[model samples]
Target: MSPANPVAGDERRRLVEDVIQRRILSTELRPGQRVNESRLAEELVVSRTPVREALLRLEGQGWVLFDHGRGFVVTPLSTDEIRETYPIVAQLEQLALTSTGPALRGLAPVLSEINGEFGASTDPARSHDLDARFHRTLASRCGNGRLIALLDRHWQALHRYERFYMTHPDDHRRSVRQHDAIVAAIASGDVASAADQLVDNIIGPMHVLLERLR
Candidate 1:
């Protein structure tokens, strides 16, 4: 028999990983749920090998954990995760903003436009997406690719938490107000103030999220 194609195998594994990660982010696969490799393989219409590979990848990314007796399980939600993840993201984003130097002012108009859309969005999911785009645009002018990449990694980990919080209209409104402050600071060329406001924007919701988890 011919050997399996490595390229095809890799694509299948990535496809499986994307589908499983999306489910986890969307909370379709709730925290602490057991991940059935065989069942997922059948559902995804792929073989067990790719499913196993994908689960291992997800494990590395902190989306799931491996257990000898129980197999893979979704990583449970915890206040500790929030405490650790939020500050790192806040600091990284602040550094990214400061690194933009004189060019940060140029991004204010774009940032304001995105924030306006985010405020008008009524759907939690839509709001979450727009909020992410607003942040991405805020940091777009920063020349440090490595900082952005690291920020994105931790930022993705916050998605489940952020998405959960977006359902509360009051909390989201606070975020919109914070975004406005950050934009105003940027437009005025007050890098220090903008960085402070940006940190507030990133870390403020964290308090509410932690309280909810507790």
Candidate 2:
């Protein structure tokens, strides 16, 4: 029997979703930036239908807002939103680590790979991608699809701030050191220490970003 085709309409939708998400997260598509359907369709090399579908999905996720007559625009990252969301994210991430403590041994190779990537990366964008992948891998192991989905949504919302930090030279170095610490804690099976490191790593950058914004 032939292997099943992996690229289906669902795959197209996911691709479109990723394109819109990357643009928004990278701030290439900034807050209040209007999404032109035809232009995005051309840029993404997809039909307008898929682009529209992706925008609708983002709208539902609070990453985009549609006005009655204004169509869709990237949502602004309000200080209040960050204040409310980061704490919940911290709790969820800690819970995931605590729940998955037993399986963390399997994650050593992945952690090592991430460490190597972070150590070798000099480009801001590449470094941020590896950092995101490392955290997402950990969260995915929580084995709760709902929790993963929730965290994914929050991460999308927080990506703008993350990108800012990733591009800043000092913050980038500190971030790598923090990730190194978390990896060490996890590798040593110190769940409490890992959880503490996770919270500090997330909240520390967030606090700095908020202060800078203010």
Candidate 3:
């Protein structure tokens, strides 16, 4: 198998990480799905070593679980896990929001562009991308590399729930409006309002998802 792009060892690891992360988050790899190492290596055109390494990383991150006889299965999150995670996520988002200063002002236009695309998007896949981008951009500005990395990991772990919300018609519509509120609050430098709006935006859809799962 040929590498699509030539990259060094660390870069190749990141590429593998990205591939697995995206597949899991997009639900291409559903919960409890067994990860076929050989098949994945063949499809991704990478050696088994990197694929194994990637799977190990994902397992450590709680996105995958080791089954006694089944090898690695995508981790399934319960409603309780979702509920337990939201408040922690909210607190992290609030920290990021409060830490924002002038550096974040540059993100305003990018956020607006993403919001515009999200509003006009009729494709579910495209909408999910936009949604991910919006939150990721917000978190990336927190000025703490470790915090940002942790959030990225959490985001990937929560992707299944997030996608469920994004693909639901009613939830998607509500998200657009809520995203606007968040953007407006941030643009106005109302940190507290932005934090509250972020929590609401996260928890509201999560409520819908939890109800559906129940």
Candidate 4:
């Protein structure tokens, strides 16, 4: 009945958004599952307003969709979605890395270390996290906040797909090698080569996931 505090409302909306995004990315919410606004509000101890607002924001981010009768549901994964989204994300990441310029030189060691752990890890979640970290770190010095944010959103959207397809043993080995090559290129001050390798790192698994989807 009363008015909501503006600051508190913003905080709650962001919190709700992040929680839902994480669930979707981890596949805990799952593809095509209805997102119950009332239930999520109760679980998060927030009002339905924030939950609804967050879901709407997520819809814009391609994480969920508003169905006429079913309300908000997790966006179902499809080969079409993969073909459309993966290349865009790959290009954005390539741009981010190329734009990072000399700053990427400083991150070469860090990226290599992360790739090492990513390859060594047996846990899917940990490996996924490390892989995300590697890509993010590689582009962190790009100095373009909007570009980075956009890339992060796309990366998170693709995370669910990547996590789902990570069961293939060969994919794991191939990713490690690709990441290693990217790091090597970066370490050698070959930014163009690193960017090319980074695109391959992304598009390579894209084909693998498409095959698995078939």
- Top model number, TM-score: 1
Instruction: Give the TM-score comparing model 3 with the true structure, all chains together.
Output: 0.81
Of the two candidates 1 and 3, the one with more favorable lDDT, higher being better, is 1
State every prediction's TM-score relative to the real structure. 0.93, 0.82, 0.81, 0.86
Q: Model 2, range 1-214, lDDT digits (tens) per residue?
A: 9875556656777888888888887788898888888888887677777788888898887878997687899888788877888888889888888888579757867886886788678887888888888888877687888888888888877777777778877887787788788888888888888889889988888798788779
Q: In model 2, where do residues sit more than 4 Å from their true spots?
A: 1-15, 42-47
lDDT score of model 4? 0.87
Clash counts per candidate, in order, are 0, 0, 0, 0
Q: What's model 2's TM-score? A: 0.82
**Mind giving the per-residue lDDT tens digits that candidate 3 earns over 96-137?**
867877766677778888988999888777888899899888
> Alpha-carbon error at 193 in model 2, in Å?
1.5
Q: Judged by lDDT relative to the true structure, which candidate is superior, 1 or 2?
A: 1
In candidate 2, which residue pairs clash?
none
2 versus 4: better lDDT goes to: 4
Would you list the rank order by lDDT, best first? 1, 4, 2, 3
Q: Which candidate wins on lDDT?
A: 1
Report model 4's TM-score to 2 decimal places.
Answer: 0.86
lDDT of 4 at 171: 80
